[model samples]
Target: MENINEALGLLLVGLTTVFVILYLVGLIGNGVIYLTNRFVPEETMAKRKEIVKGKAKPTNPAKIAAVIAAVEAVTGGKGKIEKIDKIDKIEK
Candidate 1:
């Protein structure tokens, strides 16, 4: 009975220690990210925001032709591009 009790106690302590360490790591990681973003310059942040939002620009005709050609080749002339639109990349 004593041996069983001692083993259980040790197991509990080990689990608790692991949980505390993981929690602290998560807390510190969040804090660092928050601070870094908060201190970032507005201009740089604006650029990042624009990139995240996927601001559209005129497409190069040569690039568009190349993409269409590749798609047709891959699909054996069955693929067609009706429209193209910019999509923002989602970050976790």
Candidate 2:
């Protein structure tokens, strides 16, 4: 029937319009993100650099020395005990 064909055609057209609109929106959103990243970029690289450099400081020197001493004790003098620097605890 002519009415059935018209209804099917209109349904297909509506679906096609919705798909195109969604595709365009997604494309535009991605473009905006890319542009913003290019122009107004955050300091991800700088923060990463700082994080890499910040780990170089020794946190617990006493814990490290204790671990080393235990390893030497287990190894039975194969590992000579290095000179242990006394770490004074910081009284808060």
Candidate 3:
């Protein structure tokens, strides 16, 4: 009984230590990712320009009209007209 109790105590301590180490490693990894995301410079404009140029698509006026109509319908067609004008002006 004494030996069994001692072994169980050691096992619990070992498991606790492992759990703490794993938690600390996860914390440090997350901090690194956050810091890098905040401080790292984004892709250069040349790269961005190339990427955008590669994916050009013709504008679809009908889709734009449909979305505006949906917004007006959802907003009960009252304040929506002013809201639509605001959005159009902002886009311009």
Candidate that scores best on TM-score:
1
Candidate 3 accuracy as lDDT? 0.66
Whole-model Cα lDDT of every candidate shown, in order: 0.74, 0.70, 0.66
lDDT by residue for model 3 (2-60), tens: 99999999999999999999999999999999987677666654565554564432255
Off by over 4 Å in 3: 44-92
User: Using lDDT as the measure, which candidate wins?
Assistant: 1
lDDT tens digits, residues 1-92, model 1?
99999999999999999999999999999999999889988888887676556553423556656667888999999998765444222122
Query: Where does model 2 exceed 4 Å of error?
Result: 43-92
Clashes of 2: 0
TM-score of each: 0.54, 0.45, 0.47
Q: Kindly indicate the candidate among 1 and 3 with the higher lDDT.
A: 1
- Winner on lDDT between 1 and 2 is 1
Error of 2 at 44 (Å): 10
**How does candidate 1 score on lDDT?**
0.74
